[model samples]
Target: MAAIHMRMLGYLVTLAMHGGNMLVMNSLLQGPVMEDPNIRTFSAMYKRFFTVWTMFLQLFVASLGLTTDYYTLKYRNKKEPQWLGVMRSVKNRIFAAVLWPTVFLVSSLFWSLYHYDRSLIYPLFADKILSSTANHILHTAVIPLVVWEVIFQPRSVPKKHGVNVTMLTVYMFAYLFLMYYTYIEQGIWMYPIFGLAYNKHICFPLIISAIGVMLFIYYHMQWFLTRIVWGSQVKIKK
Candidate 1:
């Protein structure tokens, strides 16, 4: 647990050291990658709007999660069960019912916008580190942290574990396959980090490490909720 937290902290520090830019400049560098529709030109369209939308939307969800957590716990009776046993309909209905659809819609929006016709409006990051780092900071680290807050809130622990585990697993695999398609189509990589070896071999480790970190956090969060906030409850037979 300590190691996992340390690793996350290390990532934050490294990102800060990079002057905190998360956006990589999207130079139309001549190579095999120019073929990608996402980066083919700087035309203005829904693509740009979608990028902004995704970043802000992620931020909003994260904020909402934190605010929700604060208010719920503020009024909640710590002595009483926040949730019933697995058999309870309300908890499952309230949490599970909208979770999948909401996630799928949001993720789909990103995938679609990423590939939309006028997609290549701006370079992900500008050439200068100090200049583009702020964008990168906002785009990568900040946005994910927001999503993390939403996924790891104490009252939402069970739903958070189930949803994040399922969604993140699916997303990682789907992105793996999509990356191959991207490489084939553009002859380049999706993330700059993957372009390290002129291929993605070095990048796989980063993805794996991120997943491990997420799982560790998930477990710790679940523990905090179960043992402290939610407490144990009796299962009612259906």
Candidate 2:
């Protein structure tokens, strides 16, 4: 738990700085960019890196894990073994077991995609808003840190895959709603793939369906990564 907490704290600082850099570029450097009538919704608060919402979600879950582990450790009474036994409960595994996949997968995919063709996934204009350091922080460095956590941390995955998938699906649904709302209000889409020109009829559903499939696949893949990195050091029980 200490290792996880430390990793989360480091990530918190890295991601926060990355975000701050993006905001400064968007507001101060590219002043007229936000004032454009077509995309003027919440111009002052617009984050240049907002299109990639998964990064934000990863930051959120990392913060949540740090907070949970901090208070649990702070409040732990080692004098009583009975109180310590509760650490293995399902509730305690939610952060590592359920949400870790999102961070690892997003980190892997974004870095790979950026390397393969920055222009295809992220256009030339995006370079003005995001720097190499910020890109590496969110996309490259995160992969190893999270993978290390998975390898080292002993976690109990949810007993029911259906439950985990359902929760993620609901989250994706809400995220999509926010994505569309932002587009309607400000005329800018966070992700290029979410652009209405992609296919108004099927793109949204396709994105959600793809996420559902990815979650299903990674739900098992995480345990495999854990097993390989840890060998017999740790075991995950459903």
Give the winner by TM-score: 2
**Best candidate, lDDT-wise?**
2
The 0-to-1 C-alpha lDDT of every candidate, in the order given, reads 0.40, 0.57
TM-score of each: 0.37, 0.66
Every model: Cα RMSD to truth: 12.6, 4.9
Alpha-carbon error at 203 in model 1, in Å?
7.7
Per-residue lDDT for 137-192 in model 1, tens only?
43344434433333333333343457545654554455556655666775655543
Cα deviation at 119, candidate 1, in Å, is 23
lDDT of 2 by residue, 40-147 (tens): 433433443333455565556555555555556766674434433454343335544455566655665566657786543566655555577766665676556566
Error of 2 at 171 (Å): 0.9
